[model samples]
Target: MLLSLPNWIIHLSSALEWGIAAALLFHYGKITGRRDIRLFGLAMLPHWSGSFFVLGYHISGDTIPILLDMSELINLFGSTALLLATLNLLKSTKKTSATSYTAALAAIMIAGKPQSYLGADIFDAILQLSSVVYITFLVLLLKVWRRDRTIFSGLTVAGFWFVLIFISVTIFCMYLATVVRGYPTLSHDDLLHGLAESLLSISNLMIAIGAHRKIREYKREQLNAIQG
Candidate 1:
């Protein structure tokens, strides 16, 4: 394996936490009778599958480029799914301006990618596009929270945004490990790699815990209403 045991644990735990968060959100939607929320939960599965592709890449000692490519492709779909689901959640409200803002932001972000579209490879372009979509999703997620705080806990929303932090740190560590330290890849420098990945674990943990809290709160409200 390309990763150490501790790194493996971090990856596995991040995936597990994401899966649990999705399941909890699904259940919360079911109990609360919110179809949009259920769809949002379902939307998370593509990214979870993408994570497994990443794990497979690592398991192969990072030799399989195809696995990494597939991960990026699937993640793009995942980001789109999340964005659409969030828009659905806002269907009852007027968010034309907000949606327009996100659209313009997405365009700007995509245009602002480091390289020109003609110069970048397909996968690189896909990754950039996915980042833009994910950022748009994050922005809309905050809008959803402001519109309906009852839909998701503040912590849950924060966890989703925390992924940006993980990405930034990973990029910096990759430069330090590969460029500065002459390592082949960030994963080759276990310490920095682990440090960057641990942030992902923390974010996933927050998502799961926040979703669980929301579920419990909803269940309690139902129980109290029934008892009363």
Candidate 2:
């Protein structure tokens, strides 16, 4: 019963956190008037939309593969959307390189087989490697905020690092349990995936905080200009 509680919460909150993230990013985009941010917000919806199918998949058992495949598709789409959003924020030739790499990885993930288990699969590997893109996005955002001397830069950076840690630990646990231990069960991967889902809530919360920080900074800048 104890072990089941967090799993239930994580499963349910996966959709909730994603919905909240969408709302926050949409609000942030509107406030900042950034098209890229708005697109990112739009991308968030499909990420968690698979939760419905996941719940059904569990209830109906593994007889159906479509639901599982849907989840993988959603994951690929969300990541691709994030990559596009990140590239949109930049005005450099590097954007093309980033686009190529991100598109290639996303294509690979999309073309991968559905992995319902913790075993080695192209899908799982692509998902793990996609973390590099996420980390890069956060780092670039942090640099932008740093240059602007935004009050939220430090907190944003902290949040980014926390996400990195969470993903790394989750991946390590997955490998240790599945590959090293030679266990056939998905016990470890399931637990870590749940934990990662919860961490996503924290990550989105950080974004909301950054949105508020942006507002505060804008006000300060306006006041200083008026005073001058």
Candidate 3:
């Protein structure tokens, strides 16, 4: 594997953290009796699965470009799933047609992207489309927060959006690695690669911690109610 032991640990931790976050969110839904939230947690699975494809690509020493492409494609679907799940939550609060809104936003987001054979350009387009979907999901999340903060803590919502920071930093680090340091890829530079990936771990940790706190608070509230 091209990744060092520490780098593998970072990657593994990120995937595990995301899984924990999803599980916590699902548990939160179970306790609160919110099917939409549960669906949201389930929607996170595709992204988690995509992460494994990433690990597989790394394990192949980045030789299997197809694995990376599959990861991107799966991530695009994951982003769409997340967006739809959030829209379902919003539907409970507003009478708006979630399907219609999702369709329109998806159309707009996908219209300009150049479709081509499965290669760098195609993968990049998929990444861009996924980013748009995720951003839309974040916007809807904020709206959901406005309607109901009890479903998720503010920190949890913030953590979801904080992924943008990880993306931005990773891009910058890739530039530094390839362009500045003359490394062929970010993975070629262990220190900078680990630094960039660690941001993902931090963001995932925030998400898990926030969900756990909310779960604890919800249980306490339930206890007080029962006692009273």
Candidate 4:
């Protein structure tokens, strides 16, 4: 039953995820060449890498331990990267307070490490906070669009997709938590987890596409300015 799924399906999904990540990295590099975004993108690479690792583990079964270890590392990296990316984006908008917010969230996540048995609570809190932040961020994007419709058109599209994905993940996470607490016997947490992961992958892909478009637009603007 191993590798029962079509090989093409697996490769196609992997290719799409990595391709999106690469596009985001290229755009981030071109924008400001900032080390933070580059590092963020690098941190994201492992998640996609671990996906393939897990797929291989599924097929072989012998490498389950290695795949689990890799997955843990990837999760940690992604957690940190999400905080860093949000901070960087906020900083780009000249929001100095966002750094402090990011630091607080990072501290909470660090404190909630599994060794302390408080990681779950911390992670849950982080998710809740992220949901609020995402909503606020979307509102800000809407306000920006209203004020200067053309200035951030590409970003607006990107933000829309990002918010959609964020909302979907948040809802699924909430449902999963509820199911775990309320129906421990018939728990469908694993399915929920898979759904969340898939949604996140999709979200990343969408953001990468948005970033690519924004990068192209920025380059066009630069060229026009130069020629004018």
Candidate 5:
């Protein structure tokens, strides 16, 4: 269903998705005014804006090295933001430290800038692998704490799994591109990419919904405390 879409439509859908997600995150952050939430929302901003780069490449049909470079840079920043957000989440649990996150960041930082298809694929693979560990741990935490009874606990666990799937799919795509010709298509129309995008957007929305419920509960508690 996704691969057949026209170029304009694909990127348009991407814009709609990441745009809505960013807005939700940002609004929630403003309401809570928590530093972690604020940073998480801020991290979402670039992923939304970065869709334009995908659109630019599609509409223009020009694979400029600079354009790809810029998009990759934006992607790196988003990854960093993701790492930070995960670290923030871990603060409450204290199950892990920032050591792995730091190592991932360092790996990305020390790596050479991706200038070719293979280079880009390798760089992205590393990023995905780095995130997979933290995300997996989060999933396990949710499973273990399943009895906590938070409204969001289920959704958050499922969302993290979905995110893991998307990242794994992305890594697989990189592998296929390495071995397959006409990979990702010169036109960039791809079923795997489309599926990954859809899954990611859905996962974000699901997590956002769960987070909103948590906020509502927090507000209710605060109001009740004030009354009591």
Candidate 6:
């Protein structure tokens, strides 16, 4: 089966995103006096790691003995990291306490095999709930931006765009996977999955860039203040 343009684009984009993310982390370190941004960067690491795992599975055609056993472990850890990152970001603004609690609950629900026994409906519900939480966080961030536009301007812009892309793609894919499952056929599955992955990769890159830029701006401001 030949890969479509979108799939190819996303694949290449993901590979590049990893590099961009690394650079952004370095820049973030330079700007922020706090080391906590490292946590955010670490949270994003699993997405790329999962990408590699899937890629390896596709290429090998045979499941790795250890990986098969560890798949659930990987998923749980990765999902938890993502959820924590989302919560941490919200916490930064000191808003959305309810959303943070909901996110935490959802993460706990996902820790076990709820999806395996409850089926797609349950999984979809969790995902939808998460989507709402993230959306709310996005709104809160925008409100913050309105108040103090320069506080974390670069990071905020990048984070907003990244979250927007993520939420858009996630909702679309969830709908397709649930409502339109049979219409497009199986071939479309691979293409959609690849496209979704690519979008997430781009989102991560944008966030990293934004965070890096914010850090630089913060440092410049601090330096100027010190001199004055």
* Better candidate number, 2 or 6, judged by lDDT: 2
Over 4 Å off in model 2, which ranges?
A: 1-3, 50-66, 92-139, 147-161, 175-184, 187-197, 212-228
Give the distance in Å from residue 92's predicted Cα in candidate 6 to where it truly belongs: 6.4
TM-scores for candidates 1 onward, in order: 0.92, 0.61, 0.93, 0.56, 0.61, 0.56
Best by TM-score: 3
How good is model 3 by TM-score? 0.93
Question: Which ranking of candidates, highest TM-score first?
Answer: 3, 1, 2, 5, 6, 4
Model 1 TM-score? 0.92
lDDT of 4 at 199: 53
lDDT of each: 0.89, 0.59, 0.90, 0.53, 0.58, 0.56
Model 2 shows how many backbone clashes?
0
Q: Give the TM-score of candidate 2.
A: 0.61
Models sorted by lDDT, best on top:
3, 1, 2, 5, 6, 4
Cα error, candidate 5, residue 169 (Å):
3.9
Q: Check candidate 2 and list the clashing pairs.
A: none
- Extract clashing residue pairs from model 6: none
Model 3, global lDDT: 0.90
Distance (Å) between predicted and true CA of 102, model 5? Answer: 3.7
1-228 per-residue lDDT for model 2 (tens digits):
222567667667655755765676676667767666677678667666766776666555445656766776566566656656655654332323445555655565455533432336655544554454555556555644454443233654465467676666666767776887775433434565566556755765665566566666766877899999
Poorest 10 consecutive residues by lDDT, candidate 1: 111-120
Off by over 4 Å in 1: 94-115
Cα-lDDT of candidate 5: 0.58
Q: Residue by residue across 19-107, what tens digits does model 1's lDDT show?
A: 99999999999999989889999999999999999999999999998999999999999998998888888774565554675577668
Candidate 5's C-alpha runs over 4 A off are: 1-10, 92-157, 170-196, 219-228
lDDT of 4 at 77: 52
For model 4, residues 56-131, the per-residue Cα lDDT tens digits are: 5555633454654565555455545544554555555553566576566556646656354434555444444444
Q: Comparing candidate 1 with candidate 4, which one achieves the higher lDDT?
A: 1
Q: Which stretches of candidate 3 lie over 4 Å from their true place?
A: 95-100, 103-107, 110-120
